[model samples]
Target: MNLTTFLVYCVIVTFTPGPTNIVILSSVQHSSMRQAMNYVLGATMAFGLLLGASAILNRMLAGILPSILSTMQIVGCLYMLYLAYQIFRMGSAESLEQHPSGFASGLLMQFVNPKVILFTLTVIPSYVLPYYSSPLILMVFVIIITVIGFLAFATWLIFGSVFRSFLLNHQRAANTIMALFLVYSAVMVSGLL
Candidate 1:
């Protein structure tokens, strides 16, 4: 509830690089800022939904469907590996002829992301617990976290958008970066398993 603690939580959740950010950055390399913004919006909505769901179902989920969480994590890890393969195998834009919209992809990706669930289940609740007795207070905490998440993600998307041209110009280097990111994602996903 304290400002210091809230800020610390935000920093940890928003600033650390994760699969979502990596994917957004990759999208930016092939799409426009507008598309990236779409991804951000979808991602932000997912965060809010997760936060609200955690508020309502934390106890029930923990007690009845704990294995479900583990299954989600494994599935998410496999998906990340799949994404890595996609990135590495991607053909040039001229060959592909169409760029997928980042927004739609971003929105859908959040549904399967294990990190988002982990964050909602773990970090988000801590910020809300102090205000548990009051509905208004809890809502306020969720709103604050949601807003901060949106802003932080927007910043990253904008950064990637602005630099997308540079990435496109250097296709080889960009692919190399993508490969590295895929490896990083795989390692992170493995930790969950």
Candidate 2:
């Protein structure tokens, strides 16, 4: 196992703009720091859970991955579109409160987020499992990957926080861009790209 290759892949995939990152950016721009942190915490937990599940069930999942992926794709696409609509019309405290970017939503989002789903499912099997089959080793890799995911989420929050003022100043434009990104993500995950 080439450590550099694994590290690079993990970094690139996690750090890239995806549904979760975009939502984090939107959360920071439209909500408070506490709210964003809640979302981050939820996302991190779900990410860790997914990684652990993948590590333990990789072999079992191999046979049914196709069917599961198909269902996930549809659910994920619909969910993303719903999020896009919410962001696109973001205004007023009622709307913000109604669509709170909190822990529960963040946790649920990861379960259906195809980008994250694919990454968590494939990374271990590709990079860790082949090299180390021991339960202890796999657990260590899962923790490491989870940390990477948490870092990625935190980075997006920081970025959004840093640009919060600018984003607020151009709220409509910012929301539009973020919504568009989410739509693009939905399309890509839908296998239409």
Candidate 3:
């Protein structure tokens, strides 16, 4: 088991920009830290669950993951569009109110995120299975990967927090930019891009 290689894979893939991280950053910039934290928790927990499922189901899921992922991608695309609309609407409102994304929405987003699902499906086979065969060791790997995932998300939140004040002052511009990002993410997720 090359712990270094496995950890490196986890860091690179989990930390890369994706729907969950984008949403988290937008949520923190436009909403609040507490809301962002809830989102982070939801995304991270669902991601962890997906990792475990992928690891255990392994070959079983490989045959089916494509179809499931397609469905999820469609759902994810629609949801991302909706989120974009929501962000645009929030900015358009005469009085900007914090309509932070909730836990359930966050959780659902993760389930539908192709990036997460595919990452899990591949990671288990490439990193965990070869290195650790026992169920116990696999579970430990899952836990470790999940923590890494959480930390990756936290980094986005921290980054968004850094821009909160600027976003507040430039609400309309910020919202527009963020909403466009969501829209782009939707297109990418749906394979239009």
Whole-model lDDT values for every prediction: 0.60, 0.73, 0.69
lDDT of 2 at 45: 97
Model 3 residue 93 distance off true place after TM-score fit, in angstroms: 22
The TM-scores, one per candidate, come to 0.59, 0.65, 0.63
Clashing pairs in 1: 39-103
lDDT of 2 by residue, 50-123 (tens): 99998889634534573554555565566667657766786622222224699998999999998788777666
- Runs of candidate 3 with Cα error greater than 4 angstroms are 59-100, 161-193
Q: What is residue 19's positional error in candidate 3, in angstroms?
A: 0.7
Which 10-residue span in candidate 1 carries the lowest summed lDDT?
90-99
What range of 10 consecutive residues in model 2 has the weakest lDDT sum?
91-100
What lDDT does candidate 2 reach at residue 71? 57
Ranking by lDDT: 2, 3, 1
lDDT of 1: 0.60
RMSD of each: 7.9, 7.6, 8.7
lDDT per residue for candidate 3 within 1-193, as digits (tens), equals 4466557556645654457766777787687788788888888889989988977786344355635445555665676676567666653222434435767767889899977876777666654554455778878888999999999998888876654455557877766776776666556556564
